[model samples]
Target: MAMRRFGVAIVLSVILMAAFAAGLSAAKRGISVGEWLSVPFSDASFAKRWGYGETNGARNVISADRAQQRNGKPTLRLDTNSGFDCWVYFPNTKDWDIDLSKAKVMRGYLRSENKNGWGGDPWIIFVDMAGRKARFDGLKQRLYDAINDWTEIVVPVGADLDAKCAEYGWKAQISPGFDWKHISCVQIHQDTDGSGYTMWYSGFEFIDYAGRTIKWWLSSINKPDLSVTYAEQVPQYKRYIASEPDPNYNIPELVGSAATEKHWPNEGEQIKYLVHIKNAGFARSKPTDFVCMIDGKVVKKASLPALAPHQVTTIVVNWKWKQGPYQFAASVDTKNKLDEITKKNNTLRFKTDAYVLVAVCEKSIVAPIEQVNNWYGSFCFEDWMRGATIDQLNSLFKRCKYDFAPNGAEVSVRLGKIFLVDELPDDGAKIGEIDKGLGLYIFDGVWHYPLRAIHEWCDLANDFDWALNHELSHQLGIIDDYQYDMGPDSNLVNHKAYDRGPGGIMGGGQVGDNVYPAYADVDIAGFNLTKGHRRGFFGEYLYCIPYKNTLVLSIDGRPLADKDIEIYQKSMYTGKIEAPPVFTGKTDAEGRFPLANRPVPKDFTTATGCTLHANPWGYPDVVGRNGLFLIRTQVDGKWYYGFIDIGRFVCEYARGHKDNAVYSVKLMPE
Candidate 1:
């Protein structure tokens, strides 16, 4: 009996190995018994669902035929005669729209009719209802390496779809609206020279991954960890800040009044407090309760849905704008409904005032004041800032983690009043200064510059709003994280790849958005009303912003006043100093060589109007080395030397700690 059982087991093992040898491994192919949505070209009705188009006047014939079917299944055939390109598309029609949110892969079988194989590359594209498209190309060699027989071509359509497509040159506009919920269309392009070729395709299907079992180890000791990450107040009202007459405000009878009235939100305005809850655990969490309180009174109570591991959801609690200040608190699973990894972060508390007053510098002693008092037309800076800049600021603070590590506070600056003022406290009347106690932002003129370079030809703009946010952050106790000086360090090896720091608004205006994380130790920080005035927090300049630097040159305690200095930098490729100077300029009366506010050199400008400042620092096309420039000046037939390294953000070696740093050297006769 034992011998007979062993013989049967051997026969079963042989059959299983034989099946695997015939390419029947489900795990290898990511295939499972499931609901598969397919586009089988079994009949002529497929032509109705699919449309064909040509580019470069290409001639092509596409049809469904049973003659060249794969495994007795009808196949779609494409014959290319004479053109640069041709394509077949499943249009964005009502009948073809598919919900691919749960899908894992879109795969098909393809074969070439010619013995030597086809000469063109094949590509597939998926378009969402929002008109956003994701295209994947270079499949000629990838999918059909040797395709006299049917070859399998797989493209991931799940969460990793974009990443999979990106491996093979994906071209797509990524928008928040471009999601998998409604995939409207699918396209296949044949990119070839006007050569005659034929190809057949069959078994195009979308495989789902939802029902697939994910193997995860479970331990009785492990528990779900739920935490309230952060919270913020979102005001739901319209405000405008404009320095020009309202062009769209037309009330024919009250046109005069409409133009002058700054649209500020009034009392009793609706505001939503958003609480972010995260399941920061290895296991999924059960459905739980969320509670929100305002000034110790329960304002909202709602049930939260069950959350997967690491999933986060924001619960919104509505409130009306009341007079004075209010304290806010939120908690998840308040009743200890489920065991969690930790309960320390399950609740959060913060405070904010009902409204904040913003005083504008209408009359500046430094610059001319432009004001239009009449209702017919007026330069309304208040409305313009309220409408655009403040909204942008609030959006940034909603994501800001200030005064705390990891989970920062989100505070809102609700505009209470917009009044003109001639002066601000503590010299805040100076341009770019802001008094947080008074919400006063001193504006001199248009503040505009390139915050960062998106590419060689394009730069991201940092205008009035950027300067405002940076200054406002200072008032909120956020200290400048940028190094402000250039001190000598014998051991400091300035390399482009080595110089890296935490980049954000505090780090010398290196970011495009104000939502970058920052830290502050002052008592009154973020958008909170728990305030006691702390002096010397605002109006301070960053030690070094990107592309700008200031250096004081002196010798033997005497300034190198009005002297010509040459700037020479080492070649990144050769590691040798270039003979001809990159820039030569005269020092100021105080021997200050201010490299700030200097425009890109004409030599660095291309005919295409792109700046050659594409390297990490503002230097031209240096490959590896940091932008270290040597300042050389001749005095009494002797040369004095000093160095400044500009590589992305300033390194620890270059940090001099002084706002105005000095570099002094005595020229020696050799």
Candidate 2:
């Protein structure tokens, strides 16, 4: 799902502490005026319940004491003039520490100062003690379409919220181990256009459907005899067992895996996916068999335990994986064992990893190819190349087999078609471009350079070979990691989130000879193979310099120009400096400071400490803080700073390879 449709623009970053207290009891079986777990912003003191959260850039929020009168009611206000994003968090205060295990929905009221002035939907996040969060798109709740007055916002919590997360493609934001009982904090994030605007929020609460409203009472009484709803309510269970891509790919389950390191599933490995079955009916469900099928043949059938109303259970189905095309389907009650309402959702189809390649070249270039028959084979000379070319193409493509799996399992890449054309299409097609199914154009020189002038076909063959594999990767739906067309800037080549590691076909590896897809590249290709073309960031960052080796400073996505920078080692949690300035220097014309080959300290102590893993697969599935540092820079008479996680960058991304441990710091001005 496109996040823009939901209007959520903020990327939340905050570390919350733990909290626990007795919660209100659920009202017994009736829709009555029950006590609501709520935090009211009716007065300025509401600020005491909330704290300032993290932001990517400079943004500000006024203190709660500055509460303004809106619609004659005291409402808390936030202002953004920094042209950047920011957020505020409620850290599960003792007074508002309502247990969310029994909560059904989260409701609130919000208003904007100017009509239709909202930039995007605000995000409401629930973070548990373990840092696993349940983040939701607040657009639906905030009533974004019409936001003149105080609009009532409704957000489903628990299982209901999980379904909503899946529907909106927000499953990636949720970390594993998130539980309703351990909710430690709540954060509301917003976007800005640089032009200042005011947003007010009030009356935030978590309520239950069974105990709260008259609507719950009416629905209970008006039930149509036997109603049943079975579905994959959790986002984590919706797809094949693959790691979700990032707004922050640093999540441990993704980067800290063999799938990213050694690229597993070489010969024998198990392909796994989670199957969630929910009983959303009023009555309990009798035990039935859960059937799993591959290619329309039942492969696994297991007994399912009876489930109470609103209860959800997950079944793990796995098979020995091989490189090829496959179709997976699962059903809850294949034999119609449960006599209830409709069973339309009992079966579901899963995505598969399979691809075919088509190679084509122009006819005009064929004659020049025949003359060099001694050096090049006949298949390379023919107008519609055959024989040797097919075998070679298949070999090159099959090399991508290991990387093609989404998470080291389920993959296929086969050569499909080959042909020659009199003239390539001039529909804005660049040199070495491949259409989705249509074969790619194979010519050496630019459009202006005619094929008649090309005499040495064998010499151009190497470049053509590289282009062939590189373009084929694009046809499979992977994107280039490096940036282009930006003139005279050293930092223009890389992105801020460069964590995919160094050389790979999609990145720096293209400059070398034998090109193959990176582990990250293949993961993306596999995702597109099954998930279709959903909007997302795949290979998010360009390979920059090694961590702390060279500091490339940029502000507002532009090079900061010549400036002075200070570096220091600091505690990860508290910003307390553990050491004085390690190095101080002025940036060059491109805002780059060469650190004289100084490496970041590997033994520095971090807030969360560190764990050593022999290989990527052995790494724990939790993010840790090891070697964290502070970088302070001065640009245009103002100071800016940001933290760099050298320990994590090395452990997860670098993995002892300096070239793979690249990083660039972007500081926020004070």
Give the per-residue lDDT digits (tens) of candidate 1, residues 230-280: 454554222212222333321011134433442323468787766777765
Query: What TM-score, over all chains together, does every model reach?
Result: 0.27, 0.29
Report how far off residue 43 is in candidate 2 (Å): 5.2
- Regions of candidate 2 where Cα sits further than 4 Å from its true position: 1-43, 65-72, 92-97, 114-117, 139-148, 162-173, 211-670
Best candidate (score: TM-score) = 2
Provide the RMSD of all predictions against the true structure, rounded to 1 decimal: 20.9, 27.3
lDDT of 1 at 252: 12
Candidate 2 residue-wise lDDT at 8 = 16
Provide backbone clash counts, one per model: 15, 2
